[model samples]
Structures are given as structure tokens and as C-alpha cells.
Target chain A: MYAFNYHRPASLAEAARLLASNPEAKLLAGGQTYIPTLKQRLARPSDVIDIGGLAELKGITEEAGGVTIGAAVRHAEVAGSALVRRLIPALASLAEGIGDPQVRNRGTLGGSIANNDPAADYPAAVVGLGATVRTSKGRAIAGDAFFTGMFETALEPDEIVTAVHFPKPEKAAYAKFPNPASRYAIVGVFLAKTASGIRVAVTGAAPCVFRATALEQALAASWSAASIDSVTIDPSNLNSDIHAQADYRAHLVKVMAKRALAAAG
Target chain B: MRISMTVNGRAVSGEVEPRTLLVEFLRNQLGLTGTHVGCDTSQCGCCVVHVDGVSAKSCTMLAVQADGCSVTTIEGLAQGGKLHPLQQAFHEHHGLQCGFCTPGMIMSAADLLQRNPDPTEHEVREWLEGNLCRCTGYHNIVKAILAAAQTMRGMAKAAE
Candidate 1:
């Protein structure tokens, strides 16, 4: 990593102010992705604003309606959280399934969502569960609109994700086939409830995580394993990386969706 | 950066560079060479340590990030010149060969045992998926952890 000025701000406003001051600044979260990028010299920011020390950015909160997770909370904490296990075992299981223990211990939700790795696991949950992304800029992003493209989000350069609000779904599950080496999802599916109806989000399939409209509609009619078994996804725009081809990923999406439905049951 | 952390039951402080990782701080600054850095990416558990009682990878975390936090490393597990049960079990069961991954393997297993004392074979295997052991095929390591669990259980019963 190149030599850069590091700032540990005690408050969010100060961090935001620091970001506003330096347009080339980067917010340092879990560093699962960013740190490696920095080491590879892929990203060389003049200022690194370390967000790990911000107390407001950590912890799990379960409220009367739903759960609001501080963005910087570690994946291990989410996986082991008693509150999450009781309310959303699917989310806990998903966290537990992400990468290895090291990745889970150091990776943060804010970092994962912001980095938007094509194989990441959080995008599925954020989309399928109808979660909301709250930013330090005081803006809230609906999951659908939050993810724009591969590694691209609605976040502007100066904004930081402060928290993620997961609306407690009636039932939900996430199933994924991880790239054995990187532990990234080869094809992942998240099944959950939305205010409108049931939603199924697929990640590691396309340029970004997306909802399978056909599967969602089918499952809406009959929320069952059989309902998803018949749904065939089009593979025109899926990702074909080293893990798998577009067709293989497409096949995995359907298979994972059925498994997710089965797990949800 | 001036960082202070309670490491392995000792309160230690060090002035580190901003880019210094917690693993570097522990191994380089404090001369606690138990932790190893296998991959710069956080994929490997070779740098795992307990941060405030929770197992965390020291490589991905910065020393400055650990300020005021309590840390327990592989060195902290032993007491009074006696080996930890996990260490003893690993030693007896041939849990490692080159010993490159033993510290991390033991660190992660200690955490798993703390969480679930008597884990099923599947549970042990699932929990240990994070700690990769290239040398040992994990058969003996699993046996060791299970044996350690039984030994601890016997110790608990004997004390009663």
C-alpha cells in the first residue's frame, strides 16, 4: 500500500467533512476488498478515512418492526448474533456461509455492499429481503435502486453507507454455490418477502445481483419448491467468469432458487 | 499511530505506521511471531486472533483498530506451564506436519470448542472450513478436536 494520510474521526460528521474536503479520499471499512486492491496498487487514494472505530457503525439492533444493522458490523458478528438467529436465521446462515472465518471476521456489510463484488453474498439479502441502505449523506436507498451494475452502486463519491435496514420478512432463505477457491458465490439466490409480495434475488449470475422476475411471479402464485422447479431463467446477460460460464451460472440460478425455496419451506 | 491493546493477557502499546496491519503489529512490533500471514487478502485464517473475545483475522484488521480492545492470541491459551487441551490433543493426534497452520488451526478450533463443546463431526468440519490445512487432510485434526472435547468433559466431571 502506498503512503497515505489516515484519519480516525470520532464522529460521522467529521468523516463526512473529511471526505468532502478530499474528493479522492476512500472510506476504509473491513478492507476485505479495498485493502487487497490497495496492496495491488489498483487503488491509490491520497486519504484513507478509517471507519472501523466509529461506534455508530457497529452492532445489531432488533426493533419492534424489523432489524437495523449498523453498516460496518463484521460478518462474524452478524453470523453469531443471537438476535439475528432468533429473528432471521436465514440471514445468520447466509453470513455463516460467506467465505471463510477470516473473511467473515474482517469483512463488513458496508464494505461488501459498497464494493459490490459480483460474487458477494450480501447483495442477495439486501435485494431479496427488501432492505434499505442508509447513507451518511442522510439518503436512503431501496435495494433495487441501490445496485446499478457490477461494482457500481448509487453511492456518490462523497457518501458513505451508514446502515442497512432489513425489513423482517415472513420467511426467507439464501442458498449459494461458492467458487471453492475464492469462496465467492458461483450462483447465489436469496428468497424473501416484500411488501408487494414474494421476491427472489439472484447474485453471482449477472453483472450485478438481480431479481428473477419469472421465478418471483411463479413463486408468488405458488410458493413451493415445485413452483420454482419449472422456472427457467434466460442466460443472455449472466456473468461468465473463471468460476463458471453464463449458461452454467444460469443453470445454477434456477437450481439455487429451488433449493432456496426448499430451505424457506 | 499510537495504539494500545491488551494482548495475550498483557497490556501493550506501540507506535505504528498508518499502513501497519494488526498482524504486523503483533508479529513485528511486539515480537509475537505466532501469527502468520499466508495471503494478503483476508481469505486465509493464518492470522486469526480473538478481538474482545471474538475470533477475528488480525491481517485484515489494523493495529490502530485494536486500540482499547482485548486480544487473545495463540500464545495466550496456555497457563502455568501446562498446555491447553486443544494443543495437547493436536500434538497427540498428529494434527499438523510442517506446523505452518497449527497456530491458526488451534486458534479457530479453540473458538469452535468454546462455542460448541461437543460438536458433531459435521459441525466440527463445517466450523473448520475457514482454517485451511494443506498438509494434514483434516481427518486427524477433527479427531483431535473431538478428543479434546471428551477430555475437557471428563475433566469437568472429575472436578464435580
Candidate 2:
């Protein structure tokens, strides 16, 4: 990796100040994604602000309302936490099933969400669960508005995700078609309940994670896997990578949704 | 860059380049070769280590990020001429062959057992997915962890 300045600010305010001072600075969360990009020379920045040790960005809290997961919490924590299992077992299972044990132990929720990898599993859960992403800039972004495209997000350069709020869902499940090697989702589906109603989100299909309105309408009327039998998602907007073609992803959207629905039961 | 960390109960310090990865710092500067680096990307687990008791891919972390944290490597598993239960079971079970993936497997396994002591075989396989072993097909590796869990339980019973 090319040489760069490293800073570990003690507080979020300090971290934000550092970013404001140097507009080209990048926050180092778990480094599972960014470090690789750096080593590959995919991205070069003036400085890296390490946030792995930021205490405010760590923890799993379950209160009367919902679960507020610290943005920097590792995937392993979500998969193994007692609170996550009891509150949202499917969410825990989804985390547990993410890229091998090492990745889960090292990759952070904020990092994965911020990078908005099209094949990542967390985006499905975030959108389907109708979560709120709270940033260091004191701005809250809904999951629908957070993601824009592959390797892209609505996050500003100066904004840092401090925490993500997952409102408790009545019935939620996530199913993914993992790459045989990389374990990234070829297509993943997250089905969940929200105050507005039910939401079905798809990832690894299009340039960004998106909602499946067709499936959601069916499920809202009848919360069963069979309810989505007639629904057919269009593939025009889906992405085609080495893992699968657009047609395959279009097909996976329904199959995985049914599986997730069955699993949710 | 100059940084200090409590490595396996010992205070270690080093001066390194700004882009020095934690794994490179440990192996090149500190001479803790037990923490191997398998892949440049964070995909491989051969560089896994404990940063403040949680398993993290050292290759992905910058050395300076670990300035004030605690780290535990494969070398730390054995103490006072004794081996960790996992190490003993691995030796007895032939959990390793080429040994290239041993350190990372050990680090990842320790973290897994810490979180779930009585993990199922499927869970073990799932957890070990990040740490790739091109040898032994991971049969003995899983066996060693199961045996270590039993040995740990026996030791706990004896202590009681």
C-alpha cells in the first residue's frame, strides 16, 4: 500500500474535525473492505482515520423499542450475541452466515453498509428492516435513501455512521445465494415487517439494493411464501457479474424470497 | 510511525512506515513470525490475530491502529512450557499439515470457541469459511477443536 498518514481520534467530534480539516481523509472502520482496496491500489487517500477503537461506535443494545447496533460492531458480534438471537434470530443467522469466520469477526456493520457492496448481505436487512442510519454529522438516513449504487452510497465524505437502528420486526428472514468462493451474495433477499407494512428488499441484483414492491404487496396481504407465487421481478436493472447473469439473479430473487419466507415461518 | 502495544502480556514497541500493516509489523519488525500472512486481500485467515481479545485480520489493519490495543498471536497460546488445550489437541489430532494456515486457524478457532464453546460441526465449518485450508480438507482441524473443547471442560471440572 502507498504511504499515508494515520490518525486515531479519541472522540467522534474529534474524528469529524479531522475529516473537515482534510477533505480527502477516509475513516478506517474494520478495514475488511477498505484495506483490501488500498492494497489493490483501487483507492488512495491522503490519510486514514482509524475508528476501530472508538468506544461510541461499539455495542449491541436492545431496549423497549428496538435494537440499536453500534455502527462499528463486527459481524461476529451480531451473529453470536444473545440479544440478537432473541430479538431477531434471523438477523443473527444472516450475520452468522456471512463470509467465513474471519471476515465476520473483522468486518463491521458500518463498513459494509457504507461501502454498499451490491453483493453484501447487510444491505438487504437494512432496507427490509427499515433501519435508520445515524451519522456523526447528526443526520439520520433511512435505508432506502442511504444506498445509491454499487460501491456507492449517499454518505458524505465528512459523515461517519455512528449507529444503525433496527426496529423489531414481527417476522423477518434473510436468504442469500453465496458465491462458491468469495461467499458474497449473488442475490440475497430480506423479508421483514415495518410500521408502514411489510418490506421485501433485494441485494446483489441491481447496481444497488432495492425493494421488491411486487413481493411486498403480496406478502402484505398474506404473509406467506406462496403469496408471492405470481410475482415476477424484472431483470432489466439487475447487474451481471462473474457469479451470475441478470436472468439468474432475476430468477434468484423469487426463489430466495420463498426460502426466506419459509425460513421466517 | 512509532507505536506501542501489549502483545500477549508483554509491552512491545516498534517504528515502521506509515503504510505498514499490522501483520507486517508483527512479523517483520517485532519478529513474531507465528502470525502468518496468507493473502493480500482480507479474504484469507492466515493472518488472523486477537486485537483486544477479538479475532481480526492483521493484514487489513494498519500497525498504527494497534498503538494502544492488546494483541495475542499464535505464539501466545502456549505459556510456561505448556500448550493451550487447542494446541495439544491439534498436535494429537494432526490438525495441521503444511502449517501455513495453522496460526490463522488457531486464532480464528480461539475466537469461535470464546463466543460459542459447544459449536456444532456445521457451525464450525461455517465459522472456518474465512480461513481457507487447501490441505487436510479441514477434517482434522474440526476434530481438534471438538477435542479441545472436551479437554477444556475436563480441566474446568478438575479445577472445580
Candidate 3:
């Protein structure tokens, strides 16, 4: 890991100030991904601001008929939170299935979405549930617009995510075919019946999490697993790697969508 | 940066580079080699330790981040010169062959028993997903953890 200056700010404003001052500064949330990236020398930053200790970004609250989770809250905390379990059991279960026990203990929702790994699970939940991400700059970015591409997000260089607001869905479930070693999704699908309409989000199959409009339309019409039987996913836009071929991921997407729909029931 | 923390019920302080991992600090600075580094890629749980009573991969955590937090390593498990119940169970069950992953397995199991005292066999196996036993002695490891859970439950009842 490259030697860098570490800063632990007392407030979000201070952290933002440090970021604005140091153009190459990176925010360290959970360090689950950042630390590994550093160890691999994938990134060299002039400064690292630790936000894990920020009191302002550390709570789970019920607000406006949904749940607002602090950006720094760990995956294990979300998986174990009674509030999350009661309000959005699907999200809790999604959190539970992320990585493994130790990774879940330190990985944060904000960090996971910010890193925006193509195989990450949170992006599916964010986009499927139509959640809102609040930033330190006081911007609420829709989940659909938050992720730009693999390892990319809509966040500005100095913008820090403060919280994520997941509105209560009528029903939601996530299913994934995980890689046995990394536990990352080879092809994952999140199905949600929201106030707006039926939504289907697929991850680990593309450069970014995307809505399966065909599956959404079919589920909206019939709300049954069989409704998506005729809907075919194109393999051209999907990711193909050693874990699975693009065509195989395309097939798993439909299978997982069906599984998620069944689980939502 | 100078960081201070409680390790094994003793206060310790050290000056570490910003890039210093907690595992490195424990092993190099403090000379606590009980926590081994297997993969160093965060895939293996060889560096499992309790920070503030919750298990985390020390190799993935920065030493500076552990400041003001209480850390419990595998070396801290014994009390009054007696092995922890999990340790005793592992010894009796021959849970290890090379003993390379034993510390991490024991620490991970300790955290599991703290949360779920009476874990089923499946739960024990699932909870140990992060831990890797290269010797392929997972059957005996699971057995030991289950047996230790029972013994710990009995000890709790005896105290009651």
C-alpha cells in the first residue's frame, strides 16, 4: 500500500473540506474494498479521510414510510437490525447474503454502492426499490441514476454519500447465483412491487445494474413467474467472464428473476 | 500516526504508517503472531479478530482504524492458564491438522457462540463460511464448535 496521509474528521463538513482541499483524497468508509485496492496498488491517493467514525453518519431510522440508513452503517448491522427486518425483510436478507460473515461485519452499504462493482448486490436493491441516495452536498440522486458503470457512480469527487432512503415496497425479493469462491453474484435479480409499478433489476450480468423492462412489463401484467417465461434477455449487453459466459448469465438472469418473484410471493 | 488500543486486556500504543494493516501491527509491532495471514486478500479468515466484540478481518482493517477500540486476538482467549472451551473442544476433537487456520477458526467460532449459543450443525457450517481450513478438516472443526456450544451452555446453566 502506498504511504498516504490519514485524516479522521469530526464532522461531515470537515470531511468534505478535506476532500475539497485534497483533490486526490479518497473517503474510507468500511475499508473492505478500499484497503484491498490499496494493497493491490490499484489506487494511489494523496490523502484518505476516514468516515467510519463519524457520528453523523451512523444510525438507522424510519422516515416517511421508508427506512433511511446512515451511509456508514455496516452490512452486518443492517442484516441484524430489527427495524430493517420488520420494514424491509428483503433488504435485510440481501444484506445477509453479501460476501461472508466477516465481510458483512465491515462492509458498508455506501461503500458497496460507491465502489459499484458489477457483481455487487446492493446496486440491484437500490435500483429495484427506486431508493434515493442523499449526499453531503445535499443532493438526492435516484438509484437508477446513481450508478454510471462498473466501479463508477454519479458522485462528484468531493461529494460524500450521507444516507440511502429505501421506500417501502409492496413486495420485494432478491435471488442470486453467486460465485462459490467470492460469493459475488454471477447473475442476480431483484424483483419489487413498488407504488409506481412492478420493477425488475438485474446485476452481475452487465456493466451496471439495469431494469429488465420486459420482465417488469410482464410481471406488471400478470405478477406471476410464468409471465416472464416468454421474455428473453439479450446476451450482447451482458458480461461474460471466467465465471460464466454471457449467454449463461443471460439465462441465469431469467431464472433468478423467477426465483425472486416466487420468493416475493 | 500514533494509535492506542486495548489488546488482550492490556493497553498498547504504536506509531504506524497510514498504510499499516491491523494484522501487520499486531504481528510486527506488538509481536502477537497468533493471528496468521493466509491469503491477505480478505478471502481467507486467518486474521479474524474481535474489534469492539465483533469479528472482523484484521488484514482488511487499518491499524489507525482500531484506535480507541478494544481488540481481542486468539492469544487473548485463555484465562487463568486454562484454555477456552472452544480450544479444549478443538483439542479433544482434533479439529486441526496443520493448525495454520486454527486461531482464525477459533476466533470466528467464538463470535458465533457469542451470538447464537445453540447453533445447529448447518448454522455452524454457514457461520464458518469465511474461515478456510486448508487441511480439509472442516468436519471435525464443526463438530468441535457444536460440542463447545453444548459445554458452554452447560456452564451457563451451572452458573445459574
Please compute DockQ, using alpha carbons, for every candidate against the native two-chain complex.
Answer: 0.59, 0.76, 0.90
Task: Give per-residue CA lDDT, model 3, range B1-160, as digits (tens).
Answer: 9999999999999999989999999999999999999997998899999999999999999999999999999999999999999999999999999999999999999999999999999999999989998896599999999999999999999999
**Which of the numbered candidates is closest to the native, going by highest DockQ?**
3
- Across B1-160, the per-residue lDDT of candidate 2 in tens digits comes to 7799999899999888768999999999888999988877787789999998988889988888888899999999898989999999899999999999999988888988887878888888877887888888999999999888888878878999
Candidate 2 residue-wise lDDT at A142:
95
Model 1, C-alpha of A158: deviation from truth (Å): 1.4
Once fitted onto the true fold, the runs of candidate 2 whose alpha carbons sit more than 4 angstroms away are none
Candidate 2, residues A7-120, lDDT tens digits: the string is 888998899899989977888888888888899988888988988778999999986667889988999889989999998888898898788776776789999999899889
Give candidate 1's whole-model lDDT: 0.87
Full candidate order by DockQ, most accurate first: 3, 2, 1
Best by TM-score: 3
Query: Which residues of candidate 1, in runs, are more than 4 Å off?
Result: B156-160
TM-score preference between candidates 2 and 3, better one: 3
Cα lDDT, model 3, residue A107? 92
Indicate the docking level reached by candidate 2. medium
- Positional deviation of A146 in candidate 2, in angstroms? 1.2
- Per-residue lDDT over A1-265 for candidate 3, one digit per residue giving the tens place of the 0 to 100 score: 9999999999999999999999999999999889999999999999999998788889999998889999999999999999999998999999999988999999999999989999999999999999999999999999999999888999999999999999999999999999999999999999999999998999899999999999999888898878989898899999888899999999999999989988999
Over 4 Å off in model 3, which ranges?
Answer: none
Winner on DockQ between 1 and 2 is 2
